[model samples]
Target chain A: MPIYGVALLAGCTLVGLFVGDLIGAAMGLEANVGGVGIAMLLLLALTNLPGRDVGPASPSGAGVQFWSLMYIPIIVAMAAKQNVAAAVSGGAMAITAGTLAVLAGFALVPLLSHLARGGGQRGERRDD
Target chain B: MIDVARFADANGLLVAFVFVGLVMLVSAVLARQVGRGRVHASAIAIALGLVLAWAAGVDTGGKNGVADYPLLAGVGVLGGAMFRDFAIVATAFGARVTDLRAAGLAGALSILIGVVLSFAAGAAVAIGFGVTDPAEIATIGAGAATYIVGPVTGASLGVSSSIISLSIAAGLVKAVLVMVATPLIARRIGLDNPASAMVYGGLMGTTSGVTGGLAATDPKLVPYGAMTSTFYTGLGCLMAPSVLYLVVKALV
Candidate 1:
């Protein structure tokens, strides 16, 4: 049953890669763009379709759920693939970019939270 | 006994899985006992993985890290772009459209704003550092979006592996900071309710960090935050390579 999920994922990945390649070509780039992201969107759309019985309780859904939870292992594999030594030796650019991004995220949290409250109030008022 | 090295080489993928599993097991324990459950096990595992990879790179004098060894050659395939993409795409099944709707307009906007702002921050830093290449800048910017997004964008852009690794490192640093800082600043940020948690998750955009932080702040809010953070990663992945990359190219 999990194999079925893997099969579905494979199909989605293939189609996603093809489309991504096409988009890249259209953009005049030589690389595939967002293939994995596209495949994910397809999977999300398909699994969440109305009247779909493939919720996490079902067999095929279980297969999908299994891999979803297995993100840790997969990520671990991905992490192992990194050459941190080389990345560090490359320069301080990586650290600077990473630190600034996080600091920026933290700095804007209050602004975003304020925006969310405004939107929430508007939604609540509309509902009433 | 019977050519164990040869056997490991023959079943490289399985061996790699087993090796990573062992590392994860240790990481899980460290996260609990040492990190006090504040840090997610995956974070610890990633740090360990990086250390091991660096050590392997130093020892083997190979660019591929541990995979440079014949016995661990399967690590290359397992951690290659194909399997990485497969695993990432599979995570989509966990999200439901209904959940996204539940987060409301604010939640949706947060994801959009979060991804763009994060990208901008990363790109600004890249530019400040004298990196002029658009693809490299975009890849690093995407890394600011999330670790997953960084590598995905990098691979899509066909950037160098070192740049991809840097993006990943950037993401890891962000994740760790979010995890550590969330609880400390929860009260100041009014992060008590489900609504605020969702917004915070969207803003943070790291699933593990948001979930772990919310769990530490208030276990009841984990799911709400994690849900939006999931969408954040998804949105970042979609936008970083194509839209964000183009924007960076035009600007630079």
Candidate 2:
């Protein structure tokens, strides 16, 4: 994964953003519809293309891996908090939704786990 | 010493990156020193960010908090879709089709069930709060599915910013619960195997929550839970702004 490979990813991400913006416009929506999803699809396709493979354990592979891994934990963790804080002040509705959703999720678990069980000890344990 | 503030304003994004990096670093150190790894750094960082954003909001008298400052305007771009979406897309590289097959029908079922149930729960809450607009209801509902889903759905539907924010809040609440509760109740739920972990992840849908919770319970199960949770976010994104919104619109 040389600098060029990283550059290619940036290029693909921009292209994907453009395409997503276009889709959002076409649908008359304000959001980019699956821009990252489209970008990932493009990257996957581009990476596997002819002559694209530098070799086994290539630097490009490592580069893409590095960026991808970095993107997830840090960026997602940060943005989600920002978004939530901004919205929590919106009103009581959101607070209600947040609190209820958690409670509902908790209530759903036992029922879901039971339904998920196929049989045997796992299934039997639930009854007790 | 030409205006230091102006330089920060010009390089706001870079400055923001540095500040964010510092926050993450500090959170990690604190978590290590005091939390003994029980409190994840990511959680601590989020709390710190919230406090900073609140301080910035009060100082600047603006809506965007830290982003209201010219020197910190880059926070928006740093946390914007460009990077966020890149991260989401990047997750695909780690996944393999063969590995996904292990979950089979159970995993697949969990994703659908998780999305619908979460959506319904959120939507019900919104309606109880007297929300009439179908788009608003759906956006909040989608947020219940995942914070990522809420914004995507809200943006796609052109809902109000407040609604999108609420969605994110709902998702975050669910995430925190998942993180704290998963470990405490793993045994009672029989969440011991890879297949069960995948199902649990799907049912939860928040990747951070699923991964963190699973990590607290059994680190080996983290990958499996995260894989399905990732899929759950993608699925929620697809359904929330479209099929789910349409259904809600028709009903209301």
Q: Which candidate is the best by DockQ?
A: 1
Best candidate according to lDDT: 1
Isolated chain A: TM-score per model? 0.81, 0.58
Question: B37-57 in candidate 1: lDDT tens per residue?
Answer: 888888889878878878887
Q: What is the per-residue lDDT of model 2 for residues B1-252, given as tens digits with 9 covering 90 to 100?
A: 698779987886687778788888988998789877666677667656656766665566566656666767777777665666666666655554445666677777888888888898899988888889998999989988987788777767877655666776677777777788788988877788877788888888888788888999999999988877877876787678767887898899
- Reference-based lDDT, residue B9, model 1: 88
List iRMS (one decimal) for every candidate: 1.7, 3.6
Tens digits of lDDT, candidate 2, A1-128: 36766777787778977887797778776666666556765776677667667332588666667666665344533442253345555557766676676556555656555555663446365253
DockQ of each model vs. true complex: 0.61, 0.38
